[model samples]
Target: MRMLTYISVLFLAVLTVGCGGVSLPKEDIFSCEGFEIYPDSIVRGNRIYRAVSPREISNAWTLPDSTTVAPEFISTLPMADALFAKAVISPSFLTPEEIWLSLGFLRPEESMQALRSLAWLPENDNEDFPYSTLSPYWAAAAWEVYCATGSRTWLREAYDALTRMLSRQWKLNRSALSEFYCGIPRGVTEQSTFYPASMDEMSRFQTFSASVNIMRAYSLRIASRMAGELKLYAEREWEMEADKLAGAVNDCLWLPDLQRYGQYLYGDYYPIVSSVTDNEANLLAALTGTATPEMSAAMVGELPLIASGVPSVYPYVVNQTPLRPVVQALYGLSAAKVRNPRAFIHSMASVWNLSLDANYPSLWPSLVMKGLFGIETTPSGLEFRPMVPEVFGGEKQLRGLRYRDAVLDISLNGTGDRIASFMVDSVSTDSHSLPAGMKGHHKVVITLSGNDLNAKPLRIFEPVTVPPTPEVKWPTANDMKIVGHDRLLHYDIYLDGVMTQSISTDNYHVRPGECGVVTVVPTLERGSSGYATPPHVCLPDDEVISIHASSITPRRPPLHFIKDPATATNYIELAARHNTRITCYVNVAVEGDYFITVGYSNGSERCGIRTLGVNGVDVATLLFPPRRLNDWVHVYPSTTSVIHLNEGVNKLWLTYVGGTILFNKLTLLKRS
Candidate 1:
């Protein structure tokens, strides 16, 4: 596969060299390889890409690689009329987040229409959740809007919207991605298909991506900068928060061995090992400086490549693999900064190939202009810092480039990442920055300053090394040793699929014979991790097990054990607002669906509900109907739907969601 990629890459280099010396046409928009790319065409979608003509949406189009709106997405909805009555006034394409990053290459004044065409601050009345603000993707597009136009009016409006969204702080859904913390839950993010139903429920719960935390840090930093600009007093506070969050990400997600940041941290409080790395995580880590300079070097030097370009996530799983053009551009831009020309070319090739696969022949030319050519639209004018590779050797000219009221004809003659000389309309600027705000047609010329004497012949861009999956031994019924990683912080014990205990130290002990089977996952120091490792079920044993609530320890504080004539056993009293957790192991002889009945007392006027968890996975929501105010009830009043359980030890846990309820006992009966 490496040889094939190398060969394909070599073929591309040959084609590039063959076409290098030829003069490009004088077009209003950039053109190459028989394709025309107007700055607007990239987002509006050309005939070359999958152009949708949805009646409700504007003329703009979604990226061929992005989420595709179904043909009948709005048309097939039952209440389309009522739901879309407002959007009809100005239908928009919300698919402009990543695409916004490319706006950095176009002048702000000229590109305002394109920028404005995007569904501004996309969301419901008070719901403005931004992916870039929540996850780092290198190209800061929303920031480009102000940089492009230098409009303080737009800045103030955006600033206000940002403040309003930040005020809410992602409380809409308790598990939604938070702007200032590692808040998004794995169950909320992943679908059932992300992990098979047979797998341990812990596979995807309470997991938080490093990108979210890093993005929060970036958001705070940007907020601080903007606040200072807008004369808001909280700049210092936001700066401190940004620094703290960045430091936390460094402390938590670093994987020394891989020299990359782990995609996420799994588990609550103390996390288990989530030894996975994705393309987006690494790119963001490097681009945002979340990864140390040394770590960034390691990433560029050692991160492996997949059959396609950089795999969206390392260890790309079948069918679950994700592809996004925004992701590729960021990765390529990072490599460009590091002077690895191969990475940029390969990314462009990857996007070209991706376009072929999606049947969208045209690709984003900004990948070449903004990233490789290093020509950026600036508040003053334009900044030129070309990072030309050997393949693009010889003179290159870009004409009819729009900047405010000016049309630019930029000519480049470079082979390395430095400008030997630069001039705009016969005027010299030592800063290599020329004013685009000046009116009328203009000419800009730049030549490579660096010799690049040691530039190697074009070959394979990046190495392809697939890291081995990390594993740990399962614990036994009796006491056993903890298999630890060098960065190990703690360990979690799961029986069958239920998580029973979290061990913080070496000495591990549990009941023998009657205990459920166990599996273990490591917790890294200062970080959390988890596994999709399926639990072992179906042991040749069977019996009725009743777990008394009094024997269990409350996962949270301030719980009472009340004694009453309501039942044979005392019950654990969960306060009205205290969210408590009780974890237990259920040993069954047969693998089949079973009914779970709980003996509890709920005398409050309002009904109560408890979330039931099996193997650390949220399985069902249990309802505890209210009883009379004084009547103590404990006759197994609450029963759950028949939950499938493997023969052997399985986990059964309940979380106090609302109302006051006394947990007396939990009994599991095999369904006949």
Candidate 2:
């Protein structure tokens, strides 16, 4: 049965070959696990269900109660009321069962019981897409309940609900399949939900997903331990289907050189290709036993770049860049080197800094307190791993680790693995024979010794002055600027209020009045050869900000590619070397709309628009290419095509075909 399941998985994976290729980080045994999920996703998912409570609002716009905390905050937060409420209320989609099923929760069942208030969703079925976005909870809540009680009734109900949901969304109406199938409007309505249908994506094509992947991955992992607890093991077909879905997902999303999976896939198209691979794909692939060697290798090698100690969609990956502290540790661990434990531990400590920068200081604290500092719930009591990273074998100081109500101060005697005795609030523990695992947020002190596993004597404390806190700012949204011949946007440096260096046109002196108005109309390259311009900074690294535009209004000007304008009147080239979002506006009144020709670079195989938002303002239109990048490179309009854009700003962002996009220019003209 296992062999059959594996074979089915491999076959389904072949389907994703059309999705594209990206280089994945080297495999970290710890990182591998199909349907691996982010802690934020669960927390965020729970928050969504709580936000839509009927008692809270009529439409989806009611303000949350300031005094009365929502279900999520109540349970997750450590306050008495919050804890009490979370223990009983059981929000619509949250349940102890599902919480227990989470990979992060050590005592899953206990955690579930702690947040019991969020047990089941309200029983409202069909109203007005009431559950349009909140549908994933059905599976989540059901899984939780089954895990808690091990009741056959719960299992059946959960299975039935999931199957129905799959049928409703993927089969019957086929809603939200891929951007190639249906292009929905963006904004509060679509952006509010995390569970984007394949339509809202470019990497997920003809694949089954949602909470199913997570549930199945956990089920397969725990089946051996649970024994006769759940019947999922008996259903071989379910396992087969799950494997198939995982295979298809990989085939459709994984990219080789880029080393990550697309956010989702479309019909032979992967659009909106962000530089970072989706973390969900990484985790999911690991759990499913379907991760390619290449994928694993890329992640393992690039561990230094991963900030959260896990891959995510945000913080992008750079080639050959120095690894972040935590990532470096994971990388070392992935390589299984005990000799370099200091580097790993020291890197782990530096993770605290990244936490501050990512605007989530509380998050890494949770990990450091629990995972690294060695706080966890194992079958054998609490375990603590206090190995700190040391780049070089030497004496070091540890400070400000809060355990319970006490603050801990410890000193390391040496660089290597020699156990030097140290005092924790006056009590001492040997550095060498530290306990196996530690619980989250516990104070301890010990002296470090020897470079190798050999123990050393206790040494004196060495404390460095605390560095001044640097001001951290979010990256600016206005990174790109478009300028015409008359209006040039350029970059200029102002030293002591006097404009000095400038980035363009001429070396002419600028009037002091026109100083700050200077912008860097960056000279964009057609190929990926030029050094990537550092994100435009408003200040030094202490308070740096990005210069990219977040959202552009009034729509971007239409770009027209010219192919010997004197000869080839209509034909122009469409190419780009990176993923770009281009929105074109057209004012046509004919029943047949204008033809926008999309072209790709040389090795590019697919390209398509990930989103199309139209207010139905464009009068008279036909043939919207539901699928742009596929077996072919260009899309032609059809008389019966539904590709109609509103009269005003028809926003569309084209991406590379199955590969990367290096769009040169757009070919715009009447359909004729």
CA-lDDT, candidates in order: 0.52, 0.32
Give the Å error, residue 50, model 1: 19
What are the models' TM-scores?
Answer: 0.57, 0.34
User: How many residue-pair clashes does candidate 2 contain?
Assistant: 120
Q: What CA RMSD would candidate 1 show?
A: 14.6
Q: Which 10-residue window in model 2 sums to the lowest lDDT?
A: 36-45
Error of 1 at 578 (Å): 15
Regions more than 4 Å wrong, model 2 = 1-110, 113-119, 123-228, 231-233, 267-276, 287-294, 303-672
